[model samples]
Target: MVAPGLRRYPVTMRLLILIALLNLPIDVAAAEDRRVFFGTWGTAKQCAREPIKPGGTFLAEPYEIGDEWLRQGQLWCLLSWGPIEKRPDGYFSGAHARCGEDTVRQYFLGMVLSDGELTLRWGFPASSGPLRQCPRS
Candidate 1:
């Protein structure tokens, strides 16, 4: 009992449709969205130097933002971020949990990306100036 004017495809056509679906491209857009902020950002000197260790010198280390994780040399804070939300003030914000040594801290992150520079503001009265993307070694 077929419905009005609707025709069923043969087995060959069904197989072709399955093959076409399998040949579709991978979810590249999802990958791109996850890596939108994936890069190492810092001053030229920081980018050139090797990553500093925990409890090491207090130099302003660069930030390495990767898929779902971020790392900074100073204090060895490794941050795990939730979804980033776009704000009305031309910035993106997120809530992140940072783990360093024996301490864990939570903060709201506000970031602005322009050109190849990334500016970040978190914590009270603290901010990161314009940091440029590091060159690949």
Candidate 2:
């Protein structure tokens, strides 16, 4: 009792809908796994009292802990105290402390620019510098 064209339309729409539903989770998972700041960064400018130097580099590794994407890395020659939280403005802020022969603690703030350059600052002794992204090997 149904028209020949109408029967194919319903089946076609259902197939399209099913395909979209199947891909939704995969698309979401891919987005969550991809991180914008996951790489090594280096600078040619030196900051007083900072560990990274004109030729030195640091690594940024992004991981999901709970419901947040945290970027963890070493700065000023010490491991970060905790994961740095990314802000709405694309900047990350956290605290780090180093212990050994000389103990040091600092609050860290950094941002990745549109050109892929990184700018960082460490409180106390006041160090700030610009870093460029390094090529992956």
Candidate 3:
């Protein structure tokens, strides 16, 4: 028979290792959660220079605003080059968002795409706000 002290040792170690292995992807993604936001045309210029999924966009509508943040605000639509990194949790991160001139009035934007939806957060020296995406087509 195995010694009492050693009986569960190997099994416990194996289980711990297994757990860590299972969590490996999440650990790596957590490390990549790091991100940055840009404002004005500056961030857009930089993102536009980088490689991404060409013709990306951020579209928002007034009535679609969730009840929690409800208002008859202006509808906004922004465009970008493409998809950024998609995390293990299915959240998408990307750089370089340019707002629609007439609708959004031209600002730098950052986006999180998931949940069959897109959420945009704009940044500027003076202000920022969360805007939901209304997909095209």
The most accurate candidate by lDDT is 1
Among residues 3 or more apart in sequence or in different chains, the pairs in candidate 3 whose N, CA or C atoms overlap within 3 Å are: 53-81, 53-82, 59-134
- Model 2, 55-129: lDDT tens per residue? 555433321112222233432333343344445555443434342336654344343333555554545345433
**TM-score for every candidate vs. truth?**
0.57, 0.35, 0.28
Candidate 1 ranges beyond 4 A from true positions = 1-31, 50-60, 74-91
Q: Supply every candidate's count of residue pairs whose N, Cα or C atoms clash at under 3 angstroms.
A: 0, 0, 3
User: What is the C-alpha lDDT profile of model 1 across 5-113, one tens digit per residue?
Assistant: 4554566688899887775543343445446567888887678774355556645567888765678865444455544444444335454646566667766665676
Total clashing pairs in model 1: 0
Worst 10 residues of 3 by lDDT: 34-43
| Ranking of all predicted structures according to lDDT, beginning with the best and ending with the worst | 1, 2, 3
The residue-by-residue lDDT of candidate 3 on 29-83, one tens digit each, is 5444422222222123222333334565432223232211222234434444233
Name the weakest run of 10 consecutive residues (lDDT summed) in model 1.
25-34
Best candidate according to TM-score: 1
